[model samples]
Target: SIASPWPLLGPGQSTQLIFGPSMDAAKLEEARMLLNGMDYSSQDEDGDTILHIYTAKGLRECAFAAAEKLRDLGRLDAKEHKGKTALLVAVTANQPEIVQDLLSLGADINACDVKGQTALHLAAHYGFPGVLQAILSGRPNVNLEARNFEGMTPLHCAAISHSVTTKALSATGLTDVHLQAKANEKLSCVQMLLNAGASLLSQEIKSNKTLLHLAVKEGNIDLVRYLLRIPLPNVKDFVNMKAHGHTALHMAAGLHGNPYQEEILQLLLSRGADPSIRNLENDQPAHLLQSGHQGEQVRLAARCTPPRGLSCVGKTQCIIYPATRIPAK
Candidate 1:
């Protein structure tokens, strides 16, 4: 048989060797020849072509083989109906080598689909470190702050949560590249970035609240503690009672969270934060504490304060504010 028997593949299936799929694979050059004779833009009834099928299958040789040949003809830039290029297809399949080959051919590493996220973005989000390494080896800024349709960064998606990412990134001496805000949300990266010298006082896009506000919202005790070590860059509205009419204190004293409530209050107090500042509803931090269990009052807590403390948690709960908005928000 001049040509081997085709495998009985369904739509979008590329190879069909009667033998085992991996074992029956042909030399990369065979695919190169097939590529030289065909058009990649052609989509069959299944809406996929030879290039799409091979890359999507992660067929190591087949993807690079066809891409190498078509690239020589300068037509590898062909786009599919869904606007996915061959490189995008390869990435979707997690084929790193194919991605590298495509990138070498000038495939846009930053080429985004309709969603405005680069292949590197997707690679990072899915934790494909191998592919991401290949992508960043070309010097993609790990700190480019690239966002998807949802305004999240590749950093936000990679590693674990903000704290883990911060510790990992800090250990790498790449802490200088951490981001404080993504889509206007204060994050663990905020303090890491600040400690590495990011502006501690910067505000988010839609919200005027500082990073402290975000930290409090996440219930991240560590992040909240980290931000408090710096000066509290007060948000204008919070002081004027024009915005939410609640300070970071009001935010920190939220219903379900209490991480770093102690240290946060101290930082605020050291910064001259008044425990007496009331919210729009005329409620104070002590008022928020009232919702807690018996003896959870500020007076008891004040009494518990080290020697020479004259107040009690009850006295402080509804009267005086210890003063911190659990921040890193």
Candidate 2:
């Protein structure tokens, strides 16, 4: 017989169940047997409960059992050392089924981890559209606008997520297929948040950058196209909205070597992005164009299609701001 992982304790001493990094059939049986006797509320040295361990280790059966027990004990939202609840862990680990189960069992949807990231924030940041859909479907009152430590909402997190950026950075012929799929997933999450009434214009606290600014900075053309297609009453203003004295056009224009910069610049210009709008450095989008053949192409593109209330002159493109009053620099 295999020796029990739990040690026998003498009278007046209690034995704590020791769990291995991975669970096998025997360990699963042992966990099932110990479930009733184990204290659902107790935390180990790392402040992780049996449920946390099971969820983190991807023990689906053990996690389900532990989560049910935790739910019955009204401790479903119990946090570990970093304040990550099981739901948060499930989302971070990409366990969509477990996330749905936890939500159905009443996990706190708006609970934030130590970094102030909620389950929604994690799902968005990690580009788990399935998990995000589950969270949105399970909870009606989810804080769509909930801000993390950086004051970024789930929409903001999805806009410039690390997953999206990674795909953008390492893109190639074979990876392009995967990148397109991942981009679709990110777009799904963004669309779900928008359908659920998340604010497209909400700016992060640190840089005051909106979703457009982030998408443009990352050279995410899909997101840029999708965002521009939305019917906003102030579409031009949305395109021209400034962050730190720089608009999305400025960011796209200054993307000197980015392969997607020219296409993105064209999209913004077609959407009424004013190239004449200057940043804090007093450089217009046309002025910021990279020098060379590529820069000349971008400059011609800008000059050919000036924004409303602006016109092109001989050789040099000058702007005549409308009497409606131009925005302060």
Candidate 3:
């Protein structure tokens, strides 16, 4: 019997196959044979083609097969209603093998969807170092500094990941790459981006906060120490750098109850974080410390000298300035 060239999947059938429970190889092969000669360019009301549906559902082999077929038919980069390409969808779904196939089939690695995020951006956010490296290798022109709507680079996404798997580094033959167990997975991602020359000082679009600021706010003491030892050309300037009137020091001290905030604060201070630097509200980092630990306060005081007229206050807070209009009436 001759199989019909067109799959002609109804909306319900397509939804079931795309988003329903996993189908075995026999079912998948049946669907693939039916759609073997069908035009995959047709879009549903949502503007998602068969390829988009497969990628979104994270059907690995199905997505790869659909992507290659679509590529041969000149519809590889078809956008869903939201402007996300199959590559972007695959990355978001964390389908690394599908991502590999898409890249090999010549999907646009640098294509930013509606959110202005490229495949690399999504890979970084999802902590898929393997996917990131795959995209990077397939497209030598891939921009490491690509920014999304939030003005966040791949490096920023990596730094903010809950965890990053470094297994890819070893599998990809990156033995010399430093992977610190103390800092865990997210730290590995950050390290990979750093090794790739991602700028650590790049600020977030909205908050103007640097990657170091985010790491400190996360209360990752190991990440904080790693960032401090990055060895910049102008190390002192980098340490004293402020973003939106806040420094890493301020972020560490203001983290209401983070157990590591105090240790992070000391690390920042030892690296020359100026306690006198105030935010837009003119609150010094010392003022942000919730605890009145005399030992900690004395440690901070020793690192920072008061401004010309300002004097260090008790352990509660420092940087005392006269409230009166004149020194003497």
Please provide, for model 1 over 244-297, each residue's C-alpha lDDT reduced to its tens digit, 9 standing for 90 to 100. 566666665552334346545544444444557787799875566534453254
- The order of the candidates by lDDT, greatest first, is 2, 3, 1
Candidate 1, which ten residues in sequence have the lowest lDDT sum? 1-10
Model 3 residue 182 lDDT score: 17
**Model 2 TM-score, 2 decimals:** 0.78
TM-scores, one per candidate: 0.52, 0.78, 0.70
List candidate 1 segments past 4 Å from native. Answer: 1-26, 44-49, 73-82, 140-143, 157-252, 255-290, 294-329
Which residue ranges in model 2 land beyond 4 Å of their true spot?
A: 1-34, 162-170, 174-179, 303-329
Tally clashes: model 2: 0
Winner on lDDT (1 vs 3): 3
- Deviation in Å, model 2, residue 152 alpha carbon: 1.2
Candidates in order have lDDT scores of 0.51, 0.75, 0.67
Winner by TM-score between candidate 3 and candidate 1: 3
What TM-score would candidate 1 get against the native? Answer: 0.52
Q: After superposition, how far is residue 43 of candidate 2 from its true place, in Å?
A: 1.4
What is the TM-score (0 to 1) of candidate 3? 0.70
Top-TM-score candidate index: 2
lDDT string for model 3 (1-329, tens) is 11212222343343234333444778568667867777766999988999898888877667766876788888899888888999988888876567767877888888988888888778777766556655654255778888899889988887776323333333445453444331254555566666666787788888887888877877766567788877778776677678788888778767766556656766776676766778889887767766556535534543333345444433322322213112221
Q: Where in model 3 is the C-alpha error above 4 Å?
A: 1-34, 57-62, 163-183, 291-329
